[model samples]
Target: MRGIVMAAPGDVRVEEREDPKILKPTDAIIRLTATCICGSDLWPYRGVERVNHTPMGHEYVGIVEEIGDEVTTLKVGDFVVGSFVISDNTCEICQSGYQSRCVHGEFVSQTIGTQAEKARIPYADGALVATPAHPDPELIPSLLAASDVLGTGWFAAVAAEAGPASNPHPDFAPRMRPVDYAARPLPSRSFDGAHSAGSLGVAVRRGARGGGGPGASGGSSGGGLR
Candidate 1:
C-alpha cells in the first residue's frame, strides 16, 4: 500500500508499505475507500511539531475487508465510520460518553494511519459505526466528515454548553468557510481548542431556540487531541 509519511519536518512522501491485517481478536482490517489529511497534519508539515518520521492521516471512511474471529456487528463489505481514537468503547470512560479517554484508547496514527489502501482497526465492534448501505456519492464527504471533524465539533458544542437558547454569532474572517462556522474568530472566549466543522451545526441547532449567543472555534487538530 502507499501512504503519506512525514520523513521529517516540512517533508511528506507517499511511500510503499506492507498491508495491514487483523492482529487481535477485536481487530478488523479495512480497505480504505476515502480518507483525508487532517488540518493537524499541517503541524508536522509546517515544521511546528517535531518528528523524525510519522505516518499521516486519521479520518477514514472505509469498507471492511476482514475481521478478527472475535469481531461481531460488522462483516466484510460493511462501510464504517470511526473516531480518530480507537477505543474498546466498553470502558468506564466510554460508558460516560468519553470514548476519547477510553482506558484502552489508542491513537490511529500511533499504529495504522488511515491514509492508505488498508488499515487494521482495533475494537472494531466498539470503534466503528457501519452505514446502512453504500452511501450516495454526494453524501460521501459528509459521511467522511462524521468520522472526525464533524464529531469533534459536536462534542465541542456540547461541552461549551451551546443550547437552543444560545446564540453563536461570531464575526468570522473573510476567508473562513461559512459551513465551518466553528472555525471563526471570537471576541472574548476561552474554549478547549479541539473540535470539528460540526461544532457550528450544533450551535445553529441551539441558536434556533433562544438565549445567549454561542461561540465556536475549530481546534488545532482535526480528530484527536492536539
Candidate 2:
C-alpha cells in the first residue's frame, strides 16, 4: 500500500511498500477510511531530525480486513476507531482510563503511518475501540477526531482545568470527554512537551512563563526547546 513516509528531515513523499499482514496472534489488518495529518507531524516535515523513513499517520477509523488468532473482541468488518497510542485498553493503566499509557501501548505508521489505505494493528484486542453500532455518517468525522486530536485537545483542557474539570481542588479528578462532569486522575498540565514525551505530557512554551496562563503555556514560543 502507499503511505506517507518521511525519508529524512525536510522531506516527505507518498511511497509504496509491502502491504502488512498478520505477524502475530494478536495482530490485525485494517482498511483505513479516514486519517489525517497531526500537528506534531510538522516536526519532521520541517526537518527536525525525525531521521527515519517510517510510515507517517496515526489517527485512523477503518474497516477490519483481517484478525489474528488471539484477537477476540474485534471481528472482520467491524468499523472501529483506534488511538494513536495503540494499547490493549485492558491493562491496569488502560482499565484506569489511561489507555495512552498502556504498559504495551504503541504508535502505528510513524514511518508507515495511518494515512495510507491499509494498516496493521498489533495487539488488536488490547488496542482498538469499537464505535457505536450504526453510527451516523456525520459522527464519523467526530469519531475520527476523537481517535486523536479531539481526544488530546479535550484531555488537555481538563488537565489544565480549562474545561468542565476546572474544579480548582487538588483532590478531585479532572472531568473527561463524553462524560461531561466526570473526573479522572490529575493529568499532566503540560503534555505534548517535556517531562513526559509521546502524546501524554503537555508542554508549556517559554513565553507562557511570563504570564502563567494555561493557553499561553501550550502555545509554542516558535523557538525550539532551549
Candidate 3:
C-alpha cells in the first residue's frame, strides 16, 4: 500500500508501505474508500511538532477487508465508519460517551496512516459503525466528514455548553464584553453561540486538502481494551 509520509517539515510524499495486517484478535483490516488529512496533521508538516519519516492521516471511511476472530459486530465487505479514536465501546469511558479518553488508548495517526489503500483498525467492534447499506457516492463525502471533523465539532460544541436546547434567536449579535472576555472561555469566543459554529467548518476545509491541515492535525485515535 501507499500512504502519505512526512519525511520532514513541508515534505509529504506518497510512498509504498507494508500492507496493514490484523495483529490482534480484535483487529480489522479496512480497505479505505476515502481517507482525508486533518488540520492536526499540519503541525508535524510545518515543523511545529517533531517527527521523522512518520505516517500521516486519520479520518477515513472504508470497507472491511478482513476481521479478527473476536470481531463480532462487523464482517467482511461491511462498509464502516469508525471514530478517530478506537475504543472497546464497552469501557467505562466509552459507555459514558468519552471514548477518546478511554483508560487504554492509542493515537490512530501514530499507529498507521489512514491516507492509504488500507488500514488496521483496533478494537474493531467497539470503534467502527457500519452503514445500513453501501452508501451512495454523494453520501460518501458526508460519511467521510463524520469520521472526524463533524464529530469533533459536535463534541467541541457540547463541551462548550452549547446544548440541544440552545437555539439561536434571530437578531442576536455577538459581542465580547469585559466579563465575557475576562472569563477566558474555552475553544474561542467567536464559536460560543446559539447559531454559531467553527471547528466543523475549519476541520472540514482542512480535511479536504491533500495534506490534513496546518496545525496539530494529530491526536489520540481511540481507547484500548482493558
Candidate 4:
C-alpha cells in the first residue's frame, strides 16, 4: 500500500509502505474509501510542529477488511467511520461519555495515518461506528466528515448547552448553518437548538465591541442566552 508521509516541514510525498496488519487483539484493518486533511495536519506542514517522515491524515471512512479476535462488534465488509482517538469504550471514563479521555486512549494520527489505501485501527470496538448499510458514493464525503469535523462541531454544540428550546437571533443563524446541515445525521433534538447557541457565542463576542445583541447579554442558560 501507499501512504502520505511528511518527510519534513512543507515536504510531503506519497510513497509505498508496508500493508498494515492487526497488531493487537482489539485491532481492525480498513481499506480506506475516503480520507481528508484536517486543520491539525497543517501544524507540522507549516513547521509549527516537528515531523520526520511522519504519516499524515486522521479523518477517514472505510470498509472493514479484517478484524482481530477481540473485535467482535464489527465484521468484514462493514462500512465504518472511526474516531481520531483510539479508546476502549468499556473504560469508566468512556462509560461517562468521555471516551477521548479513556485510560487507554491515544490519538490515531500519532501512529496510524489514514491517508492511504488502508490503515490499522486500534480499539476497534469502541472507536469505530458502522453505518447501517453501505452508503452511496455521494454520501462518502459527508460520512468522512463525521470522523472529525462534524464530531468536533457536535461536541462544541453540546459544550455550549445547545438544546431544542434555544432560539438564536436570526442574524446569527447563517454562521452556524454549516453545523446545522452537517448535524442532520445526528439523532439528538438538541442539535436543532445547538445552531442557535453556537452562533450566539459568536454574536456575543462581536457584540462585546458595541453593546450585546438582544438575548446575548448573559451566559448561556438552559441552552439559551438571557
TM-score of each: 0.75, 0.70, 0.73, 0.73
Q: Which candidate is the best by lDDT?
A: 4
| Predicted structure 4: lDDT | 0.67
Per-model RMSD to reference? 7.4, 10.9, 9.7, 11.9
Those runs of model 1 whose alpha carbons end farther than 4 Å from true positions after fitting are 166-226
lDDT per residue as tens, model 1, 68-167: 9999878999988766777675665555555665677776764678888888889887667777788888888887777666657665554433445554
**Residue 179 lDDT, candidate 1, scale 0-100:** 51
> Which of candidates 1 and 4 reaches a greater TM-score?
1
Compute the lDDT of residue 185 as modeled in candidate 3: 31
Global lDDT of each candidate: 0.65, 0.61, 0.65, 0.67
TM-score computed on alpha carbons, candidate 1? 0.75
The better-scoring model by TM-score among 2 and 4 is 4
- Regarding lDDT, does 3 or 4 come out ahead? 4
Candidate 3, residue 59: the lDDT equals: 77
Supply every candidate's count of residue pairs whose N, Cα or C atoms clash at under 3 angstroms: 10, 23, 12, 0
TM-score of 2: 0.70
Clashing pairs in 4: none
Measured on C-alpha atoms, candidate 1 has an lDDT of 0.65
Best by TM-score: 1
Error of 4 at 60 (Å): 0.5
lDDT of 4 by residue, 30-84 (tens): 9999999887888889998889999887788899999999998889999988777
